[model samples]
Target chain A: MKHPPLLQAKNLKYSFNETGTSTHVLNDVSIELFPGEITSIVGPSGCGKSTLLYLLGLLDRPDSGEISLNEKDVLKCDDKKRTILRNHKLGFVFQFHFLIKELSVLDNVALPMRKAGKSKTASYEKARDVLGKLGLLDKSNRFPHKLSGGEQQRVAIARAIINSPSLILADEPTGNLDTENSKKVHSVLSKLAIEENISVLIVTHNLELAQSCDRVIKMRDGRIIE
Target chain B: MAMSLIGIVLGIAFFVITQAQTSGFEAFFIRTILGTNGAIKISDRFQDMDGTVSKVSKDGNFQFFFRSREEAQYTEGIRFPDEIRNALASYQDITGISEVLEGTAELAGSSRSFPVIFQGIRYHDHSQVSELNNQLIAGAIVDFAKDPMSILVGNRIAERLMLKIGDRIVMKGGTGTLQLRIAGVFETGVSQIDKKRIYIHLSTARQFKGERFAGSFFQLALDNPDKAPELAAQIQYHLGHRSVSWQEREKVWLDVFKALRISSAITVSSILLLSGLGIFNVFAIMVIEKTRDIAILRSMGFSRFDASAVFLWQGLIILFLGVLLGSFFGFLSTYFISEIPLRIRGIFSTDSFVVNWDVFHYLWAISLASVFVVIATWVPARRAGKIQPAKIIRETL
Candidate 1:
């Protein structure tokens, strides 16, 4: 028997209004992400790939669409409920790492669990375990600025997965890294998807990275082309 | 942030110091007045007599008539002085009660003569209510009492007349003139009292004024001066005599103090308001600078309320620290200012600055500053919470 999709979106639409001018960013886009599968959305600039990722992450509301996570409709959820869902059920990785510069690597990873009402000791213990798996246990006490590009991206990954979400969304996760760092981040993400049985979605312009995913969906002019 | 905190500290400190100074001045003036006149003075001066018009028209018709006005007779003094004193002495609240005879007299020195207001009192009974014994600069109350023919003169009166403790002076009253010896010289610090007043024995005043004149008034001191007005009212109601509290006697000065209080409040509020504005501006800038952090926090599942509480707590922490430091420095400043010696001799006299160390001033400073601080913090905190994560994320990323 086939497993059900972990996240589903149908006929999603979005737009941006700038000084009385409205531009449609996404048009009738739909996709299904299955558990333990790594999927990539590849498109050019202004092609709505990031917009789709944000929509799936529930960071922004689609103008018209149906979004369901684990067979439950999320469109009807209030802001507080949506935040809980984001903290517990979904994780996000951005291109810039976006780690708080003031916090140590361990504290950065522990933040999500802390927000989810976990005790500080439990959160830190879990954060240490994740860091040890990522080979960053020794660097956990150092601030984000002290880490290399690839290490910072890995810390961002650790933070993303700290709450053990069912799906992970990455928007150009390795866009700012060199060839070696990019490969390292790519391998870590693939390992996370298979080892944790969580859905992983990546939006990237790097064709090689897209080709490495289990499946790739190409987009043009706000609609899927493949 | 430092500047804003300093502003809060200075604002609260200034408020505290101003309150202490104002309260200090009021307390000093009240103590002087109470020491001289006691807390409550009972006399017939304020009593209302029956009208001179004894008859009115019976019918409600237009009538024109002329009637000769009769000479109005007034009560000479408090009626039944001993009864009033004895009745007041039984009250637990009344600490001391003394009868006083006040009249104008002429003091003729060997080389000079001056008009003076003389107060006559039984020394033993008067000492319980008045601070006259403590105020004597020369001779003692016991010595003054030992000689009934001797009188205690004010410092200014003795100085002007070039008299000493053994100098003999002639006192001319309404009825006759008598020769008297100067027993002591006292300084009450009040310029008017020291310059134009003298103390004579109550029996001598009666003899000097003749048998027709009773004592001028009875003065009573209470355990709590603040309750004088209420007790004065009660006494007047039961005894059929008019009673005036020290506060009522100094109504004009008290009114001036009230105005001072209002102006001080306005001034302190303005300072605090300016400080609050400084805090508001600092927080506003902070919100702008931490835009990216806010976006990240929101994206990390921090609710808007949590986001706002971050800034609100920051503002409140600053307020807390500022108030604590400000109160400490305010108390220190008032103490140092009060220690500075000053010689101000006038209607109101003091040798040093009077600083009131009431805890309420500190509490008032905190309460007033908190109002402005909370309002100042809430605006920017709310603004920080309202920042949209999607918009900020899009712009920054």
Candidate 2:
């Protein structure tokens, strides 16, 4: 049986003000996200791919739109409710690793669980379990800076899934990696969709990364063209 | 972090040391004041036409006459000694009560002569209320009690009169002159006391003044000196004697000591402010530099309040450690300084630098530093919280 879309955006619009001049960033964009699938938004720079991802991730509010997560109409929620949604239901991975330099790899992974009000022991145990699955159990105690670029990216992925969110959003997550590390990160994201039944939405410029995803939504001039 | 920690440590140390030094001075000053008079004094001069204490005086002391302000009118001392003594004895906090007669007289030795304030009290009762017995640098305070003609001269008075123990001096009073032997020499660490005060027997003092052999003021010792004001109020209500505490009688030194206190307070406040500004600047820069980190946390489901709380907790932890370190070093320095024999000779009558090593001072220092840290970290923490996760993620990508 086919499942309904896990996330849906309808007629989403967003604009930016630069030096008193208004510029349209995302113009009347619509998209749907499905469970147990990997999706990619491929577009040139400044084409609103990241803007769409941000709006879907609940990091930014669209100027005018309807965003529904599990058909709950998230756009109507307050800031605190949106934050709670992000904390418990959605995970985000940025282009850069952006791990807290002060925390250890394990602590960084467990941060989300802790923020979700998990106990310290439970958070660390789950953090270790996830790190081990990512082949990073040994590096769990190491600081972020002590890890290699690929290792840090893997750690970031571990942090994203620690809270077991329903959807994981990525904005060029593998942009800073080498070809080999890029493939490793892509393999991890693909495995998460297949093995964990997690729905993922990635914004990227890599054609290979887009083609490997279950669905590809191409964008140009702030609108999804294909 | 290191810079902010250093700033906090230094600022806290300065505050703690200032408190120790100021408190030391105030304690020594109070001790000197209370050494001559006890915590509370009830003068007999406020007796009315019916030979009774009518009311409390405006100055917190007994007033004999409410006549012209310009004219010098002497108030008769406490008339009802038995009744007042019985009233004082009823209170549990009243440790000791001594009847004293205080008047001005001149001491003439073979070589020199000087004016002095003579205080006569019964040795048993006076010794219980005053530290005179412990302050004798030469001879014995008990010898003065044994011999009615014996007197205890202050260190400075002894120097000026070129007198010593066993030497006789002619004391010229208002009505007559009498020869009295110096039984003891005391140094009270108060210039005024050492230079101008002479202790003798009440009977001898009365003989020199002629009739009405009544004590001037009843000095009261308390179990707890801090409770003097409350005890004095109770004493006034019950005994009908105008009670004066040490704080009331030593009003002259209040301004000088108050200036010291205010300067110390300002010094502490300024140091905290300057150090806080330094820390605030440091944290402000850290927040700006770590804007990306803040964004990462926010995007990972942390709220604005959580974002700021991280930095706020960091600052508080640093401040706590800094305050602990500062208190340790500050206490050592104050201890060392207190050991140095300041010998502020002939002024305030202290031998060594007095430093208050009270635990409350340390706690106060830490508490003050923590308050400043909270204030200093507030703006930067809030700024950190306001960082837009989407903006950072978008810009970085």
Candidate 3:
């Protein structure tokens, strides 16, 4: 029994316009991620790895493309529907933790569930459970500012996975961390993909981390070479 | 947030205070006018007249002629006052009626003399129809009634002639002069009336004028002064006499007061609008400062409407707190103003500032301030919603 690809992007093209100059970022790129697989997209600087990640995350519109998430074509969806899809079917982790400083670890994790129309009690309950699994339940009541860099990134991961999303998109997830913290984050991502059967796609410049993934794709000048 | 809250508070406070001040002035003016003259007055003056004449010939051939004729003959004063009084007495709204003879005379005191408009009234009936008894600042109406030759001089008249209670004065009318003693001094707070008016017994006016002298008009008091216009019209139609409501008689002054109210409203509205602009500035700065946070929320699947609603809720919270604190401060301000004693003596006189505490003023302040707040917050909130997550994320990267 084989699993279907959780996310598929075909012939995606995107460009950036700056001061009347257009720079083509993603040029006719295509990719697919299978469920329960951790895939790494490794590239040099200015190679548009982050651009492709953002397009797959539904955070930006491509100049032209087809994106089918969970077997549903999503490019034709309006902004509101796209936002709903992002909330229900996808999760995101960025280089920076991006935790709201004012919110506690519990609240930061609970936000997605709350946005998904879950009741406050249910959201907090699930947040605590996720934080427990991430080994940060004791610090759930503490604000993000008080957390270590690795701890904050783990909290961001908890927040992303709180809604049981089918896919997770990570851009430079461990770029800002040290060796030990990066390994810890990498182990957490691999475990989430294997144990929870979630499709995890990471865009990073760390070839070591890419080599550790179940599948690795190399990109140069916006085109995947391997 | 503090700056925005302050703007809303100040705007709402100023609005409530302005409303209270205007209401106070308007109430004072209406009180003075209604007290000086009852709610309605019936006289023989011709208010509405139709002089048009129509003629029709059998064959539709007729010569039309137009001519100006002498004024139609009418009685000097309200005709059959007793009959009209009896007819109006059955009305539930008409509280009291008094016959008064108004005449002009020169009143001489020991030091000086001044021309005066004197109202000769039956003291008992007049007390029911007017606030004359309550207007007395010195002596008593009882004393004036006890002495047949006694007169009640207005405060301004007393001040001008240097007369006090029990002082000897002589009133010289068109026909004769009568020596009288001042029994009381009253102030109606109307400069014109207080400066030139006096009150005496109706019998004294009849004796001075002639045996055929009748009351000049019938003053009627009503249960509700606001209903004067409607009742006045009805009375005029029923009795065929000119009936003037207090509002109609003081039309010019009322119009002036109305204009003052409108101007004050505009002034306060402008102040609130400026305060709203302050709110706009603060929120705009907040949106800029929180750009990263907005981007984070947008990336977390918060809809554009949710982004906009975040700021709108901030505005609403500010509005709620502002109205609460502003109303409290507004009440305190009006209370303090009313307690400050300062004599104002021009067209209207008061020993202290008048402040009218009306719930409507607070409601109006809240309503007007909310409008301004909505307008103020909407711009920044919309900007917050329109923020592109990709752009912000890319910039941060």
lDDT of 3 by residue, B1-397 (tens): 6876877687778878877888888888788777779899988744333221123355876432222314533456765667887988988998889988887899988867899998888998888888888899999889999888999999999998999889999999667899998899998888888999999998887787663334489898989999897787667656766677999888998888788777887888776787788889988998998888888788788999998998899889988999999999989898998898978766667999887889998998889899999999999999999999878887887
Better of 2 and 3 by TM-score: 3
* Model 3 interface root-mean-square deviation: 0.9
For model 2, residues B77-153, the per-residue Cα lDDT tens digits are 77777788887888999899998888888999997789999988799999889898878999987688899999999
Candidate 2 residue-wise lDDT at A217: 96
Cα-lDDT of candidate 1 = 0.87
> Which DockQ value does candidate 1 get?
0.57
Candidate number achieving the greatest DockQ relative to the actual structure: 2
TM-score of each prediction: 0.87, 0.83, 0.84
Worst 10 residues of 3 chain B by lDDT: B47-56
Give the C-alpha miss distance for residue B305 in model 2, angstroms.
Answer: 4.1
Candidate 3 per-residue lDDT over residues A1-226, each given as its tens digit:
8777788999999999989999998888999999999999998989999889888888899999899988899999999998998898888899999999989999999998999999999999999999999999999999999999999999999999999998899989999999899999999999999999999999998899999999999999988898
Candidate 1 regions off by >4 Å? A10-30, A44-47, A62-66, A119-122, A135-138, A218-226, B45-76, B83-93, B211-215, B233-240, B268-271
Interface C-alpha root-mean-square deviation of candidate 2? 0.9
State what share of the real interface contacts each candidate retains.
Answer: 0.49, 0.85, 0.51
- Sort by DockQ, best first: 2, 3, 1
Q: Rank the candidates by lDDT, best first.
A: 1, 3, 2
Candidate order, TM-score descending: 1, 3, 2
